[model samples]
Target chain A: MNAVLHLAAASRVHGEGATEVHALRGVTFRAHPGELVAVMGPSGSGKSTLLTLAGGLDAPTAGSVWIEGTDLATLDHAGRARMRRTSVGYVFQDFNLIPALTAAENVALPRELDGEKGKVARRLALTALEEVGIPDLADRFPDEMSGGQQQRVAIARAIVGERRLILADEPTGALDTDTGEEILRLLRARCDAGAAGVMVTHEARHAAWADRVVFLRDGVVVDETGADEPEALLVEESGR
Target chain B: MSIRQAMLAILEQGPMYGYQLRAEFEQRTGETWPLNIGQVYTTLTRLERDGMVEVVESAAEDGSDRTHVSYRATESGRSEVSEWFATPVPRTQPPRDELAIKLAIAVTLPGVDVATIIQRQRSATMTSLQDYTRLKRTGRAANPEAPEDLAWSLVLDSLVFDAEAEVRWLDHCEARLRRAAADRPAASAHATPTATPETSDGVAR
Candidate 1:
């Protein structure tokens, strides 16, 4: 399988001297097309740092990040930004929806930003919402929706652009287990549909949806055990 | 074999009690499938409860004057065993254990000392590897030509594989730990407040 996203010897540091904190240290991994790779790590293990760098949301202090053969570090700021806006989707833990926009409108924003007409954006957004099983709630604002519904909307917005890469950080953290599983099923379906994805999650149950699970510690890829049976990954984690 | 088939296979040769069946099974299989005595009795009792087996009156051949209750497969048990033999056993995927999960979670929690955890795991894994190596050596010396020698060798191979993999994993673990320790502040000296964003409910990716 060809890797759609690749990180090689990536490192990210915050501050300097006595206050220096290495968020990522020589981390490396690859996420392939039609695969959902779950990044598992404790709080400061640099899993998020890896994701942000992979998504082009944050630049690595050292090493290279490649998405679809384009090295993020080599691209200009505007080039990277455009790539993220058009080819990548992000699902933040907080949902990050515009407060004033309705669920459909929030999902439509990406398409609209890409120059689609308002009507066309709305139509595409509704289709995206339906994909997440939230078409009926399209007009509802973020505040009016439940946490799970909001996350569904977030997912809708993420895939609305038909981005090849989707980066999610604790995508189901706010929802209960059943709803989380539902969200995971949706993510799995996305992979089945040929979209490459990387999800950072603490919950093993949530990560079980992925084709592979990679363990990170202090910003480096420590272990990877999956790409086959997710249940084995769960058992390995539990045995630890 | 399915549990039913295993039970019937044990009884088909002769009527033996639960403990005897278990001992025979271990002996036959070369102890590859270890079953607790309690589990053996529990399965036997269940088989009896389900009418797949029936108790038979018996006495020890040695005439110890002790009553030994035996069980034989019933007609239904024979059918079940036959069906079991016809059916293919489903292959189970290897276990993805929780150790990786815990290690992943441990690295992300605030105030967690990743280096310390890796060091501790390294030492523990090394100790286990040494113990398994010693056990394998002892087994080889004690039963070089025993009938169960092949089985002992298989067990030794598995242990060696586990230990070798663990040692390699420890090397990776320690390298990452050293990098983390060298890069981060000492846990005790830096009292950074835990980043408890009300919205940050889980470990970030």
Candidate 2:
């Protein structure tokens, strides 16, 4: 199957010889349609770096990133930006919604910037808002809603216009327990609807919603668990 | 800890023979703790001796020349079930969890790659977590209001929570081990593995 997001042996380095920092090294990853992959790692484990590279926000110093069979390295800056707008969606920890815009407007902003007409963009935004289960809040501004509702608006923005790849960095970091879980449920539902998703999270409970988990350590892929591996008992039952 | 009490608890609501009792118990726990009919009968025999349950035999009502036997909780058994529910499960003594013990000893052994052990275990646990989550995804999404479905889901949720906690603890252990190594990369190399590694909470780095 073609991957919606793929990073092949991608590596990123910063600074000179004396103080070089390898944010990621030889990390290969993929997320196919109908799958959500969670990246789990401690601080400075290159999780955010991986997300940036996959989103084409940062270019890898080595290897390549492919989004929906298109090698990002082959695309120029304008091309990459267009790809980000058309195919990729990013949700950040802080629920990055423009304060001045209403919920529908915030969601419509991306599609509008992508050259979509106002009527088409607003319709798409309303559909996305409905998909995230908050259509009634479309007219409410970011400040008019709670954190969870604001995050829902942010997600509606990311998922508007049939975006194929969703990349979320700590998508639930700012919400409370129940609200965070509700957000994860929305992500899981999106993936189930055939959009590939890659989420970077420190919380294992949030990662449990993913179809697979990739664990990073020291800028390297230390371990990965495919959702299909079916032989082992839950660890608590291992001794029994 | 006795299957007898669980059987009694179920029987408290209605009567069941040995196999029926086993099935009922399995249904409630999603078969997480399966019991053989023999074990069920053994526990039943003991419960009968203690006067906690009484068996009723009915003559062949269908004229098939077969007798049916079922046990119902006695008054004493009802009291016992109530007491069991009233009391909290004890946690003074932790269960013998092999993974925790393995890490405990692995960290002490000289020349042992504790990080590898932790990493492998984490991977395995995550796989199990995935399996459980998949089961949850498929098994849910329909008939959620059914009692049996709710029972199964609750059991799966427990396993998911346990596995996630284990992963977090593994991450925490890795962090501790890294700090320990960085603190004494030189001295710890030649020192005896049995030597106690200082774990100061005050160490900032």
Candidate 3:
């Protein structure tokens, strides 16, 4: 399927015995190259759990999560960390910018951590910053930039090294409406440029920008609707 | 938006014919609410009848083979424009809320699920809210400093805020409904559990 991300029978169970909580259960999902999928569900429905698992930040209890045909479960700690640093990009609702670093340095940190030369990392960071339409702010620190600009810098960091998969969790929650849309447009543009994206958003309008939507309910995938058939998921979501 | 007040405000700028008024209004509002020339003419006629405006020069008097007639705002028209600017938009009775109406009807109608209606509308409203945000961004990018862009951005903000409020209201409704069902277990028991299988269990999650 040319899938960039594949989760088969994935489950996440926290604690054990009396304190056991199943965050996800048997949720099989896939996102192909060039596709942006939106994962939507109410709180505690396992949306974040699924995203964390897919990004290899958390391992599933029984199933497997694969990125570009490599199973995350099979990777050792260092291997998983290396894969995460090289292959996956994560964005959060809060801008999550490093406070002490300049925007360029913040974007460059990931590459530098991966053993790239300082000069090469900075150059790549500048390129990514420019791609996000904010190269002018490359030298500005996180505190010097507005919420939107900080987010752009964060995004620049995420896609700095041509990461194939991007995972965002309510990335626009901190911005105003217009600024939020601008961020979404940038994300959409990134996905259009051929990176597989899975954004967890409660807003359907943001979901509209996605190529498809996977709806979760109580740790299970209740419904999935294609871009051409958004209304289908709407109807199903409303319990019709 | 009150087209009448907007037309009056435009006339306050200078004397303009129907076509000119339409063009000016569209220019300021970025064609968000396109003005119909026929509507403009009709509004001008009413303004003149109400002594809010006067014909500056009728097309018949010009003898220039131009069918354009210009009108200027009278003292009363200028006052109306001033008042419109001074007064805050009235929201005592909000414009007809279709979602509210649907939920109201659903709650009373047998076999109708109010929660479903609210959720469906919340989803729709969220979609529109996002679309408005996108449009606002596009407008800003096209001309950030232009008056039309600012006006349209403000309009988009209004929609976004209202949609956000509607979603909150739907959530409130859902919570209230769940609470009510929890409080009156027997009352809800008699009501046919048709649409919501999860809720039918009477163990409110």
Candidate 4:
């Protein structure tokens, strides 16, 4: 499969001089089409930094990030914003849906903002909601729905249209066990359906849903292994 | 499950020979715990001796049928099975967890990187948790409503929950260590400046 998201030696540093903190350091990562790559690390380990950079929400201090063969560094601010809207879908730990909007409306907002007609965007939103197994919930507001339902809506919003790259950060943080499993199943299904996905999660069980796992520590890629070889991760970590 | 009870329980349904009992037990429990035929027969012999089960027949004189012996649960065995079902599994005496013991020792031992041990164990547990979830998914997909399938799924969920709890406990341990370390300097300043004897009451990080 072609690489849908790529970060070549990407680095992100916050502040300058004595206050400077390196969030990511020369981390080269990639998520290919139909693959879900999970990033696992402790707090301050730059898992979120890598996700934000991959989603084009943050720029790398050095190196480059490419989505679908297009380097993010090459895009202007307006172009990058358009790219985020049209190609990259992001799911935060919080649902991040506007309370005033119903599930369908929240999902449709992105497409509508991308200049798609309201009717077309709504139709696409309903389809995406159906894809996430909650078409009936499209009319429910965020407060009216359960956390799991809201997250399904969040996923619906992320996956609406032809957005081929989905980035999720602790998407199951607030969910119960069964609900979390359901969310992982949805994300896994999306990847199986051909969207490249990168998720930042502190829990290893959450990372297990990915096809592969990337371990980050102290702002660098510490280890990378297939999901089946998780024990190998510890072996590799011991070497470090 | 105890082998003696399992045998008696299978016989509770009806009279079954040793091999038949073994097959039925394996079938009902989804074969997650394989019981050897020899163990089944041995348990049955003990059950019969204990009056929990009685052998109905050894064999007929006919040359064609001489190898099989049937057994049925006696009143005592029926009561035993019922009691087993009534009582919950004991939790007062918890099973020893190797990871827990290892962590306990690692925390007290000097020069051991307890953090690394916890992290490694967390990774291993997470792998097991993932394997359980995947098994559950595949098992359900193959046999959605089978009682056997549900039993195995419940078993897998138990493993997942246990592993998750271990990871959480490991994180808690690390956090507690950090907090204790952070409080040490403040704690030292409050101690008497003179050559006071060390107190065993001082909290160990």
Model 1 lDDT per residue over A1-240, tens place: 768899987889898977788888777788888998888777888988888898898898889999988898789988997888788899988889999999999999988888899999999999999999989998899999998899999989988868889999999898887688678778878877989999998665455456676766656565565443222211211232
- TM-scores, all candidates, are 0.57, 0.91, 0.76, 0.82
Runs of candidate 2 exceeding 4 Å displacement: A229-240, B58-63, B140-143, B188-205
User: How big is the positional error of residue B33 in model 3, measured in Å on the Cα after superposition?
Assistant: 4.2
lDDT of 2 by residue, B1-205 (tens): 7566778888887777888788777655655676878889999999999999999986655989798888889999999999988988899999899999998888777887677777778888887777776666655422357675687678888888999999999989988877777778676663222122221112221
Error of 3 at A230 (Å): 13
Q: Best lDDT goes to which candidate? A: 2
Tens-digit lDDT track of model 1 for B1-205: 2555786877887789878888666544434456778887778888999998998978887989888888989989888888787987766854675556776786667666555555456444444443443333344422457544555556545655675576466556656655565466565432222222221222222
lDDT for position A228 in model 4: 68
Using Cα atoms, each model's DockQ against the true complex is 0.04, 0.32, 0.10, 0.13
Tens-place lDDT digits, model 4, residues A94-165: 999999999999999999999999999999999999999999998999999999999999999999997999
Ranking by TM-score: 2, 4, 3, 1
Q: lDDT per residue, candidate 2, A1-240, as tens digits?
A: 999998999989988676788888778899999999999999998999999999999999999999999999899999999999999999999998999999999999999998999999999999999999999999998889999999999889999999999999999999998799789889999999999999999988788788888888767787787777445333322232
Q: List the residue pairs that clash in candidate 2.
A: none
Give, for candidate 4 chain B, the lowest lDDT window spanning 10 residues: B192-201
- For model 3, the DockQ equals 0.10
Quote the RMSD, in angstroms, for model 4: 8.0
Better of 2 and 4 by TM-score: 2
Which stretches of candidate 4 lie above 4 Å from their native place? A203-205, A223-225, A229-240, B27-32, B57-67, B141-143, B177-205
Residue B55 local lDDT, model 4 = 80
* Recovery fraction of native interface contacts for candidate 3: 0.06
Ranking by lDDT: 2, 4, 3, 1
Q: Judge candidate 2 at residue A31 and give its lDDT.
A: 95
lDDT of 1 at A227: 46
